[model samples]
Target: MFRKLIEDASTWHWWREWMLIFLGCIMMGTAFVFFINPYKFVPGGVYGLGIVLHNIFPSIQVGTFGYMLDVPLMIVALLVFGGQFGARTVAAALFTPGYMNLLTRAVYPNEAAVESLDPALLLNGQLNLSDDLLLTAIMGAVIIGVGQGIVVRQQATTGGTDIVAMLLQKFAGIKFSTGILLADGAVVLAGLLVIGFGLGTGEAGEKGWVLTLYSLITIFTTSRVIAYVLDGASYDKLLFINSDHHDELRRFIIEDLDRSATYIKARGMYTGNEREMIFLVISRKEVRQVQHKIKEIDPRAFLVVTDAYDTFGEGFKPFPSADVMQAE
Candidate 1:
């Protein structure tokens, strides 16, 4: 019985999912502690609110505020979404903030420094771009986007404004994307007033609008990264090859590249000669390999390669469910 339990724990799926969560939380933690929190940029989400609240209450770290917001959101998600969420969602929500707190402390010399956000401590003073908020916005956005993407890829949703977005989708009949934009926009507006316009903080609001602009840039950049990660982008290429060495190239593809190809009976439009055309999909890197091999095999071969955006198959992304495809 003990060995059986151990074997079940050691299964590939169990470790792989946990690894995703662990790595993703680390990414988010670093981004919050280093880029987003220090600058008071409200990039939207509970953490964005965290930054706003942290400005008002410097005693509490941004991740601590994230913890404060996430709990209620998770509870609401549980009541509303029910079986839609699993352990991974709960774990990711609870873990990321605590990790961020740790990172904040680790980087700063003390709590006072953390609150002040001393420039020298942030990213070893290499990324303290106080004078360059635009670059910092982009950096934070890309990091957090990739982090959130990794978590989402593993079927885990961090219970932040994602829950609010879904709630809007459910009760108000708003689209999910629109709901997210509205929620984040509200947060950004809140930041503009709280931190930018100087509502309830010690900071001055004279130059707050500029930070608001940078916050929007962060939001836009993060969305692009998340979209790239979720959609997998156009990293793969589709190719069609017509060459006398079809058999040899096919063999190379199968044996060397360990990739499969399809053969289509074709006749040239002008020549009217019948032959087998090699059709295949491969990654951008593998395209160069195929090109080099083709050149070696038949210098005069007719080959065409094009971007294969969002390919779904055995080696690529799995096909979405029927409902998802229909929505697409």
Candidate 2:
């Protein structure tokens, strides 16, 4: 078993997975070091909690807390969930914090600089958008969203509240999304009390509610961006064509577009007429092409198009992520 594991870990596909993870880790690290940590933005995750902890213990860096949380969490996850998630997850969880720590040290000369929250010291004042915290939150959200999205695509998680989310899904029969929101929501609320209310560092301020609102923006944007990454920019178009030029349109789809369609016998409810409904699924870009062709072939051709959430078999992904996950 050990030999097989070692051999599996050395394959080209394994390395490719690691390469993507490396890229993802770098993106996430960039978000933390340059945008998030400096501003003390708690976007909710292990790192977000780390930010809150760093405020309380100014001597320790946020990334250090990440390591402390991640290592134990990784072990607990492995024991509880088993190894179906693969080792790439462990690598991602470990590497992200190391890279964040490296970048943070490179940016801030010492721990004092981090606690000071001096814009001039953080990122050399280039990204001191604290004055424009909203913009900072949005930018950070986009970056972290893309980063975490990439990590998630590889069938691995960064191992924080995601573990909690998964556990909730398994035992409590809670939806994964709802579990995520619940876990991260609690963390954000903790941030509001600790950082905003100055319970952590004992420096009271009015930014608690304001920061809470901004954190919500970050969380929402990050979730959307991650979803966009996973689902792609646009969904496939499901086309239903009922037209005089059915044969011509079918030829255009099969011959020109190099795609296929199905025919369903149907009757118009109001007209009491029978016709073959041409059904097809095509990429978003091909929608316009198909529309124009229908217009050219038959001016009054009845055409209906709807978003195809997932397209499988022939010129599309063989299976959806949900199916692949179930099979695993």
Candidate 3:
């Protein structure tokens, strides 16, 4: 049974999914070691707060603390987000702790011994101005954001706060983006509290606030960029047409529009009558053309259009293409 399941997963492109997850792990690990951990700059998510906590209380291992934190969130996800989402969260939660543990052991040792590239700035207490807070925060955000984008592209997550967001979205009817805000907001607030207590009222305290603000900015900017880059090229339109003039519509799309169409059997929900459904995936620009063609065939045709954010096949963007020049 286990072997059969493994084979089934393999057939369904499990290796590609795992590769994306591994890429996320590398990005998260690098962000932790290079930016967040070294500079004591926390991000917005659970991992961000973990960095702060790890700095304040060096006795507790970050990996262990992070795993402990994510356990309850995963339970909430299971109860609220259903089996598939919960299962994916579980995979991410498990992988994160192990990955962080390995990173700590491998990378943290080299951190203290390594010399800063901005050694002169460090000697003059100008490291923060030069490349300390802002640089770390931006780099951390970019790395973590790209990692998250890759995971999301594969229809997975890094668990932690993301699980909480999903659960809130499912159970509380909160928007996913808003849920993310609430989850990460709490962590950022915690980081502020930690910094306030640790650095009292002094120049150091003011500097801490600056770091916090910059970190927040970095996280937001990086995540947005990742989402935009991942989504921009993938937005296509899937059009479904059911009409008496199916032949005309199909001909127009194939010949005039230079698009392909697939015919499928569909039933009217109200009438309970069999019908032919014409399905075609086209670029956003081509949607208007498809609409015009449908109208030209039958103005009364039942048409349904859905946004296809990621389509993998022929005649789609991101496929190999030959450059062509238009003569004037």
Candidate 4:
């Protein structure tokens, strides 16, 4: 068993997975160092909590707090999710904080050393772009989303809230995405209370509501980006057809579109006529071709096309196995 484990760990695929995780950690760390942390925006997850805590305790680094939190969470993951998730989650959890600390040091060595929230401006205010909350929100979302998407695609995550979300998914029978939303929602609310209300005293006079709205925007953007990266963009179209020339349309779909179709026998209630209904799913790019073929076959053919958010099968995304762990 030990030898086999060693062999599996030495494989190219294993190294590739670790490398992708490292890259993801770097991107996430960069997002925190340059955008999320400095701008005081909470994008959710454990790091969001870290951000709020860092504000209260200016002496502690956000990444350090993240590291402290991740240790226990990774332990919980080991017990709940087994070894695969445990090992990778450990790597990701460690790497994220280390990279965040390293990047902060490299960019703002003096500020990082001081343990303060005095705005680590790049090049003596030359590159300090933390003023615009909207820009920071969007940029941080995209960067963190892509980083997270990459890690999630590799069947791992940066740990923290991801572990909690996964545990909820396992025990509560909730959707992974919904679990993430719930976990992140709580973190964002906490951030609002801390930053906006100044630790519930409302004495800080901060724009807590506005910050909450920004956090919502960040969550929406990140979710959309993650979906695009994982299941692909909303480029799938589902077609439902009621046509007289079923044979021609079937042939066109099979031969021309290089796609398959399912046919069902149906009856029109008003006309009391038996009909053949066809159902097909194709990429959005193929819409024009399908329309052209349908028009040629029967101009008056009844067709309805709607967006397909996630289509998993032979032509689309394959189902994730147990190895493909989702992150919050």
Candidate 5:
């Protein structure tokens, strides 16, 4: 029994998901401590709110606020999503904030360290600052986005706004994307008022609307990066094949490509001849195989390939489940 347990723990499949989750959380925590939190850059999430609150209450660490906020959200997730919410997600939600706190202490040990990095820190509750806001926004966004994307891909989350988004979707019938936009948008706008505008009271106040604009840039960059990382690049290709050898091409697609196709009948504009056209969505990598096979079957086959996004269904991403409301 002991050896069986040990063997199970040693399996790559058993450990891979947890390892990735831990790494993803660490990456996200590093982004927040070293980049986002230090700048008061609100990229929109619970952590964004934590940044605003931390500015108001300097004694409290942002990650502590994150932990406080996440607990209730995790409860919401458990109640709404049931067992599908899973212990791993709960672990992620709890660990990320604590990890962020650890990183913050490690990276920015003292006021002197903060000031040495960016004098902007003097104004923002002794935060470690960056010289270039644009660079910080871009780099932070990429790291955080990729980290969050990896966690999400592993069927877990760091909780926070993800739970709220799921709640909105569950009760209000709002779509996850729209719910996320509303929730994150509200946080970012609130950050603009609380941190960016600052009521002419602090360093961020002096930075003014520019800080809000930078936050917007960060949010946009983060969203793009998350989408790119979560959705494989291969899924972007949509192939249109007009082939005389429909049977042969279809057989190749079914047997070799192991993909499905939709057929539509249309008449040629100039020739006034009716023809059957095959439409299929495939990964970019499979385009070459399809092309070669079509050439072998029908040299004169007309082929058109276009970029596509949000491809969901068989052989691709399924619709997001309530439990899988991914977080940033």
Candidate 6:
């Protein structure tokens, strides 16, 4: 059964890709409807601010508003970035609002206050101290994070902030992590202004601030969790080994450690001697095994190991950071 499932998943067809895309959309919609919308929380992105704007004016639907806002951003991204980027974002932009609208329409009549209002205990008094603001934020963030991780795995997106982040990274030469932080930070700050501080006083404007804080906390937590989940648990090290017994070392790594290695030719700068160099990327967990294998094969091998960041492709996927881990 497991083998069949794996085989089914490995089938590289349009239907499979579409299935993943649809699943990603549904997960994103659930996050918006069940958690974000219910709590009146805004995530980091254009959609976050759109929710706030729509909330202020009940006449405006969040889905429609979000779509309209993202349209221009998508255009900008396409113009600034490239056709592929624009195309990818366009799918997300269209699908996100469509899903949100569908969910909103379907759930509109069933609204009977999913969350209750009680001043004594926060979050409707259902969640205890153990599930306090911090915990709620962390859990919510994690859920969002996992959803996003899955989305990325499928090579799709939830649009809004993701498009902005990618555009900034490509055009401005900004790092993806930094771009995401900046984009999300702006939305969170806007949320703070609109939501007001919910600091026990229960002032008219204060609840909005409280909600804003909650949303920001949730996004921050989720982002961290997503990062960690995509990356492996350990910081990987890239090793370049040069030794007389290259074949022996390679065999040891392949057979004992079950890792593949690449060989390249290198020449000494001063000695003018050409030698074969072996390079491998290994997880921290396997470092000890690799070291032992190398020692057993050839103690005189010249090995250089360097820390690697965010490796992708065969052998491993990206792992989420502490923040991302907490999010999921």
Lowest-sum lDDT 10-residue window in model 4: 113-122
The TM-scores, one per candidate, come to 0.70, 0.84, 0.60, 0.89, 0.76, 0.64
**lDDT by residue for model 4 (70-108), tens:** 888888988877788778888999989988877776676
* Clash statistics: count for each candidate: 0, 0, 0, 0, 0, 21
> lDDT of each structure?
0.81, 0.78, 0.66, 0.79, 0.76, 0.65
Stretches of candidate 2 off by over 4 Å are 1-10, 84-86, 166-179, 320-328
For model 6 the local lDDT of residue 228 reads 68
Per-model root-mean-square deviation over C-alphas: 5.6, 4.2, 10.6, 3.5, 4.8, 7.7
Local accuracy of candidate 3 as per-residue lDDT tens digits, 166-221: 55655677644456666777777767767645632222444667767876776676
lDDT of 5 by residue, 175-238 (tens): 5445666788888888888877674236456774787788888877776666566664545588
Pick the TM-score winner: 4
Write down the TM-score for model 2.
0.84
TM-score of 4: 0.89
For model 5, state the Cα shift of residue 145 in Å.
Answer: 1.2
TM-score between candidate 6 and the true structure:
0.64
Runs with alpha carbons beyond 4 Å of true place in candidate 1? 1-10, 82-84, 121-127, 166-178, 235-317, 322-328
Return the TM-score for candidate 5, rounded to 2 decimals: 0.76
Q: How many backbone clashes does candidate 3 have?
A: 0
Q: State in Å the error of residue 215, model 1.
A: 0.8
Worst 10 residues of 5 by lDDT: 114-123
Predicted structure with the largest lDDT when compared to the true one? 1
Candidates sorted by lDDT, best first? 1, 4, 2, 5, 3, 6
